[model samples]
Target: MKDDIVLSVVLYSYLDRPIFDVMLNGSGIGGANSYGGNGMITGIRVPFGKQALTWRLDGPPGMARNGETVAMKNPINLAAEQIPADAHYLAVNIYPDNTVEFVFDKYIPDRTPRGDQIIDKSERHGE
Candidate 1:
């Protein structure tokens, strides 16, 4: 599986609705490649290179409602070594109380401007 250049991510939603979409692209250790989908994606291409990967998220409008809760799970398959040592990951959480939480794999500086968060290292899980 080491030589596999494709990464597949499948997201399942307990609510049976589209919760969010993800886009990933990067250049470096695996190469330059991009993959994007809203739900249940498969066979995303990843090129070989030695750089960091970036991701973006898109969620449904008015997704947050008071006392409403939803569950989403994304299972990603990729080689662990393909990721950069210092690269971080981003995780977004939508709570039942209409609150949003942004979690990063690495600590974010207090003064870091909005829209400029860096991804270095971290993983996120939702309850």
Candidate 2:
């Protein structure tokens, strides 16, 4: 099986307010016919207080147009300021084929009770 790289980081708000700054490093190579790849991020959605947040990176649709080359050599430094800080979660998913996707979300605790709450055999086996 081909191994992929996935990195995740959680940041907390400094004060009671919902704000945060984040930075990440990433690199990618352009398509074989293209000169180099380009990196971009698209903010999916930022909700209200106690609400969830979501975002992702640009996909194939945003890539270079019809046989063009864009050279990119230096490491890509991604930074976001004043982003929602409520239970923030960020991750970089890199596939074996070099395709990358950035996922961001706000984690909310689940308070619902279900039958799964009861210990199952798989749980006992640490599966």
lDDT of 2 by residue, 61-90 (tens): 554332232222233333343234453544
Candidate 2 to truth, TM: 0.23
Clash-forming residue pairs, model 2: none
Tens-digit per-residue lDDT, 59-125, candidate 1: 4566454223222234244454745444343333332232323333332212122212211111122
**lDDT values of the candidates?**
0.30, 0.28
Error of 2 at 11 (Å): 16
Q: How does residue 69 of candidate 1 score in lDDT? A: 25
Per-residue error (Å), model 1, residue 75? 20
TM-score of model 1 relative to the true fold? 0.24
Q: What is the number of residue pairs that collide in model 2? A: 0
Candidate 2 residue 29 C-alpha distance from true site, Å: 22
Q: 83 in model 1: Cα distance from truth in Å?
A: 8.2
Candidate 1's C-alpha runs over 4 A off are 1-4, 11-19, 26-39, 50-127
